[model samples]
Target: MTFQAETPKDDSARQVGSILAVDCGSVFSRAILVERVEGTYRLVACGEALTQAATGEEVLAGVRRAIQRVAEVTGRALLSERGFPIVPERADGSGVDALVATLSAPPPLRVWLVGLVEEQSLASGMRACQAPYATVCDVLSLVDPAVLDDVGGLTARLQRLRPDVVFLVGGTEEGAEGPIRRGVEALSLAALALSEEARPVLLYGGNSRLRQTVEEIAGPAYRVLAVENVRPSAERERLVPAQNALEGLYLEKASHWDPSLDLLRSWSEHPLQTTARALGHTVRYLGLQAGMDVLAVDLGACTTTVAAQRGQAFTLRSLPGLGMGAWGSGGPKPSPERLALWLPEAIAPEEVLEVAATLGAHPCTMGQVGRELLVEQALARECIARALERAGLRPGLPWDLVVGCGGFLGHLPRPSQAALILLDALQPVGVTVLAVDATFLGPALGAVASVEPLAAAQVLEQDAFLKLGTAVCLEGRGREGDLALRVRVRYENGDTLGVEVRAGTLEVIPLALGERAELELRPGRGFNLGPAHRGRTTRVYADGGVLGVVVDARGRPLSLPAEPGARRQKVQEWHWALGA
Candidate 1:
């Protein structure tokens, strides 16, 4: 992905102008036009088309189709008379001021990790391999004698991998280097065994002292990059340098195959980023600057991306084969039975599994209804759960906010369906505001932010995010029919409504978008709204969304009846209550 500023049109760095940001996803290529109007940034037009990266068609074909759609929507002559995208604005003021792109179109970047210890540097290496486009093809350790036989076993394994990059992680700058050096020597030996063309790029992110030694061992034939140690120590990690290096390698491989990338390279000052990493960077900015911890999930057909922030630290993890689309043979595939649990009585587990496999083979947005909807929801829930678990984020009470992105969340007919799916999947507790990226602008904004921070920030604040009201999930335990929480909401108009919510049910109170209300909630003896407000009355103000303020009286660790009839009936009740 690339972002090109309008040079002839405007030279000022901070000046407000128009930008066309394109996001290339696994299944779709989307473009959103953000322009300065009346001194504020607003999304003027947006368009999408299926991504053709792996479909035997040129990737730029999909990019052009999506951009053309946006051009039509805005009634702007974004393309020149010669049919090329006009740069630096047009004489008639028809084209955009700048262009940027975020891509998730290419396959996962293959990486071979050579770390010292499984729990120390290997663990750090795993975190470094958390890039959206990264797939750890092989993790070789020097300690493993079975694989490192006296002959060529280790060399044979490395040759078979044919990885794009070899990530050497472990050891601190001031600490151990012997074990780390051995690992580097092993990599050197492996490189020597493989042909020059097949030799992987050596990225040494281990002990700082071993840099020159590693470079010498790899020789001039291997391309070596000495980045920051992923594990500065056993307890601390500095993983961004290695991750960035890996992303650069991914782009390097992509550019080699697609000449369109070379064109974009010349046009853009900032490097392209994976969709998930872009969103993760956006969330990181929000968390650090806005002072709010956030959890964001983007579900794709081929991979599931989870981005989250806790304090100043941010994490973005992508599980490639867990999505609803095709996956590589070497990666792990999600089980079909795991997706069948959320479905009703009519849809058998085996039936759901069959449909899942087919969708995995061939992904499409159409024909999604009835059993298909159930399967999608089930798959979404599983993906969300898996992402959160892998990222070590069990979003319970006190989460600042949670945002949902992707086709499933945005295209669902009812806003409540998306909200309910998030609720079921994340099971977030306490007072947490929910929102959705309706225009799929998070990744675009993220890419734009690298070039123009203000442009991306303004668009995100004014246009990209769609308010989905606030969810008040009463935490703790309660009897089935017992009152879990009682809410008294005072609207901006001075009108008040009170409701006593029983456990095991979801209640939706009507509140229009942009409407504000002050809420006073009191939970029952065992049930709690939050830690400090357990069994106590707590008051807070909130803004409304499409579905209004939803009170999920059903306690955290939400459960449904195991019996088929009861589960189906309960699910229907909740669905109807939420207007889904």
Candidate 2:
């Protein structure tokens, strides 16, 4: 619960060994070893292993193998003759240093979402769990007898799954308690079937019921904790505390099952909630060091998590059904109707679905056809929009940076395409910047941040973060072949430049850091940036980052012709504008 940096002790420092950080996700586990050399912490080596298996013992074995591999690479002999890694004598590991490990999986937590209604409150609870990296193994909402029977079935399913935790939530501020109460009773019955050692941890965040009575019913059999309701009122959400509690439970209880968990415990003087700690640390590092808001999406096979930090406040949302992996198959696939709305006129609805289905199914393939690329971008855009909306981010809010993390975006051969996917997907409305996680290391940085804030901050700025330059957009909606917009830039040095673009045009301008430009935009016919504004002028600031200035002309609802000729013409115009 308490994360503090290890301070170096003058005499005990010599006994310190090295620090190792590991992140184990659903698909992969990675380890990074940091050793003190010449009075500074230097990355010694990194290694990875597949976490294909699901059991706790399997995961632990994977962690051990990963650590041993990394140690071999570094030739550091991190493990003793008996194979146990050394623990740091000093908090800072002044001597040889110590080995600290953090594991990310075993799907340690399971939560049940309870709400007044299946669509609204239940949806909110599920979203909250998804955001903060918790899985909603089941959802219970008010329903008829048949629905109640379905809920019973779900409870049975959960008992079989044996989730380590349950998130009980329901009702807005002033709403009915009958459904939530009934759901709780069902959960209580389910808890009775779970093992005493494996008794589920329940988090109550529902309508004001008899707290004592509910606790009495569920607590003895399960570890029950209550927090503020997620939906206090119909329109308001109070999820931060409940989310915090979930993280606490994960770190305290669930982490013990991780295969490398004991090894991590031996290394870390304090407990660490691998995922939550990683996310929290990254947000803090980005906010404090960069002095800018950051949005990161980690899309996995089974779920997609979005973490955003603005100032001191942070929010994480999970979209369980939005991933491109096998687990996402049963959820809503991108509708061809929606894709038809964004595609150029030439692409047929069936064609769009073909592209979407390929990406939805294989998610790992790349170098899609130009038309397929467009459709994929459209799907990404929709997913981001829905994810952000669920996280309570209103459209038109100023977002300084958006970072994409996960296999689909991170491993892309062309970073530009990845950036384009995120830009189109999020449809960020204001002056924004973009980047990709390159390596899925946010969680690792987060874990380090919990212990050594400065180390985490340094790694984030110097090693972790990849800056995509400033993005300037004249927000608007338009159709294919429509003259979408034009932007003119006037530098402080008295240089002026102008560009005309159509819908779906992505343009990049090379600009160095510490540079500022005066930008004017003409929203053109059939497109409006903001409130019928025309030829608006604004200042654009460019930070010397990885990818420079990108001007996105992809309009909202990103209109494209449904007809072949018109769509091709529109695509041609967009390509011409970009000199493609």
Report per-prediction Cα RMSD to one decimal. 3.5, 6.0
Model 2 lowest lDDT segment of ten: 89-98
Instruction: List TM-scores for all candidates, in order.
Output: 0.92, 0.73
Total clashing pairs for each candidate: 1, 25
Write down the RMSD of candidate 1 (Cα, Å).
Answer: 3.5
Q: In model 2, how large is the Cα lDDT of residue 432?
A: 77
**8-74: candidate 2 lDDT, tens digit per residue:** 5664544333567766565556777655456545556667666644443556556666777886776
Name the lDDT of candidate 1.
0.77
Candidate 1 residue spans exceeding 4 A from truth: 1-16, 81-83, 145-151, 174-176, 326-337
Output the lDDT of residue 299, model 1.
74
Native-to-model Cα distance after best TM-score fit, residue 180 in candidate 2, in Å: 8.4
